[model samples]
Target: MTATDLPAKPYRNTAFDASINNPSAYASTLDDSFAAIDWQASWLCHLNQLGYISKSISQLRGLKNDPAQTEKLEHTPDIIAKVLNTALQKHADALQQSLPQTKPALNNQAQTLKFVSQNELPEGEAYERFIGTTGNIPTRDNLHDLFNGSIWLTFPKTKALLNYYHMLEIKEQGIGASRGRVRDTITVFDENGAILVTAESSIGKALVDFDWQESLVAPRDKWDEPKQLNKQAQAAVYIFGHALLEKLLHPRKALCAHSIVINVTQDFFTLSLSERINHLDQKVADYMDALLSEPDVSPRKLSPLPILGVPHYWAENVQPSFYEDSQVFRSGRRSQS
Candidate 1:
């Protein structure tokens, strides 16, 4: 059977789907994105949210500690509990509104902890000996306590891949049609072997530079002047492109790099049978040929050096309408627009 006839992969995520339906999903997703990319922005956003919670808790704790506020202290936990409960309820309502309605399966068991709910302090008589000098926050454990639960932790690969895809889409076609530039394109595949994301990047310089000097003089009497040579930055653009596809398909496995070429002419791009086969599946090669043959302005297809893995999508497949008119140029049979 042909590749097109291959059976579709099946995925099951009933519990996860329901869990994301809660309002806390937004907070949790943001938290996950921060940890996955190690982007400081995510943590800063959470810190801002936690700051408000910390301030409210501190004020209440102060009132509870004062002897004159003994009556208020007695009511503190209940008030805190009510506030947390309301927040959680609001989260649920928001989730319900945002997500398409779907019946929850009885087997769904994902539980989210409410920050101000009745939580018994982690207790044990042995704590006096084993707890060490590191004390629980001398002040209330506002952010500390909230982060300990499993829900607050990030899912590494899932979040990384998702964020990568989200950023890619935004970079390509702006939020609508006119706002964004298509630079470089990336496609990610699940280990399950299905494509997860397909993205295009706007052409931007990703370059590294270095200079090395060597003596160039006759040895006997005259001192030689040092000469310098500058080399073109080895293109990471193609390496990342090839590696991304290979990793998505083989995942955690390594593959040797291979060279392939596409030639761009004034009107059409051309690829030899061997060059086409080297970079992508035969079907993709055929698709690329059809794409470049269109009447749109041709872009340059640079000479291919050694790059690794199967190409999931060709740069040319991105419709020419997405790029500026002046950028079109041809090399071999490929168009680099």
Candidate 2:
């Protein structure tokens, strides 16, 4: 496959299909124009009648809908949030409660919690601990917090793990002015992380080396991989940070991802969308575990991805000249190319 032939979306939920009975909308594909699409309506319309979402997303289309509210989307932070759906905004508050506590590393059991005001957090109480022990994620009525809650639903394990680490750091350092390296790493990722998966290491290396032309344009077919099962695609980006997703709502070239790249196995290409999400979540969690284990591993290290540069993610990326804008696809830390 060539660049033009690259798959539009790596995981499933590419667009409305025969399931929705609307071939025209299914054909437009919400992927074609990010800025032109309607977040409230057009986005929700493309889902597979009833579906789910994932953090790095075989599913952030992970979103399912109520037939009555097909056009309406509401935000509720409850684990039982199955009714309200538009763009993967469901089961946020309650998803955290359903977690199995994945490992002993975490001190608290994931259980039911109700949404409260952000102000409810005690002044000296660390935010992570408050959520860990009380099981309540004090939510504010805002997009940032709303996105944060929704991500919890998409990838509960990864989100819980992040919180555990944050709580651990806070306990050791007592929430000082300096959050230290671990918290900083978690914060950076939690705020702007995206999981970049490619079958070839060279593709990931090209991205980290700031070789935008090759990573983002060349070998584009690698990202799209030959489709199998009518849904499979090779490399993909599953947005982990709510902030990053919020930024994508407006869609700009300069926007970037603090990406962690994983060179996946061929089996990964064959798994269903939900399976892919679980795999990526575990991989990212393992990466975080490594960051905690080896001090010299550079917790601060993450590849910078000009997110829009992903093939077919942004309509403007179709032109070879799109990568020419040095402002977005800079060479490296050095200003000179």
Candidate 3:
């Protein structure tokens, strides 16, 4: 019999058709009759929708075109779910494999904590502990994960140094307080991007003295117009931390020693995924010389600066009520102390 004339599979069964109404029931009906490649593609699409998998539309289409396993099968929701679970497991395995073999020692404690894989970090006590002590762990296959993985690979020492300080804070202050402090010092919001830093002793106080409320929170008629908005000072404050951190790694002209901000324009998103990764890789390499000169892996004595979400990327920023209930833009009377 020709491949096209092969007997109908479970995917084409009438029971499968009726099971579509109840996804849980449908998944139980799935057998090995369904083509593996078709199932994988369907499952990936579902993952993309649920934010578990991050891939460009073009890449996803390419996966669907796998010629080796071509069998027509309707993509039922249940089938998609099964495929997604499989894909997630595979991705988790890959991530775990990519992690460094030597886990860092924590809190003068000789016992080392296993590096939690991305899939296992969404919930549970382990996730909470990881976030509380180590800062944020990026979700697998997402842009944040990609960037974070790059950061870890490029600046293993600096990344570990940051995590050590984060753990120390958690040990001293409770997780709640420690997390708040981390939000202030680092940009956990990968979508908008973040700049983190420790200001030089001389300029630290001055940097925090500005009236951020009046400058960043006030309502404006043309919020989208960059020129119309008076946010340079706020921008300076936001980027200062990142600039300062970079400067510490590589000290250059004294005049240029202070922090500077790098804006991620809309153009940045236009680049291909590999290009985006390369761009950031090159940016870090530019400062590798300075980062290498650091005397040791010990944590630097630095204060947590204010955290600023990327304004340009925030959809709410264009609305009139953007700053109305914003915790970040709220008065700093309590924080200033």
lDDT of 2 at 119: 74
Taking all chains together, each candidate's TM-score versus the true structure is 0.22, 0.68, 0.30
RMSD of 3: 16.5
lDDT of 2 at 335: 23
Error of 3 at 214 (Å): 25
Model 1 error, position 41 (Å): 11
Runs of candidate 3 exceeding 4 Å displacement: 1-61, 65-117, 126-138, 177-183, 188-337
Q: Considering TM-score, where higher is better, how would the candidates rank from best to worst? A: 2, 3, 1
lDDT of 3: 0.32
Looking at model 1, report the run of 10 residues with the lowest lDDT sum: 206-215
Clashes of each: 25, 12, 3
User: Model 3, 32-147: lDDT tens per residue?
Assistant: 32222222221112121223222222233333454432343334333332333333334334444322211233544211122234655555444334644443343443333433
Candidate RMSDs in order:
22.9, 11.8, 16.5
Q: RMSD in Å for candidate 1, one decimal?
A: 22.9
Off by over 4 Å in 1: 1-43, 47-52, 65-67, 75-84, 94-143, 149-337
Worst 10 residues of 3 by lDDT: 41-50
lDDT top scorer: 2
**lDDT (0 to 1) per candidate:** 0.24, 0.59, 0.32
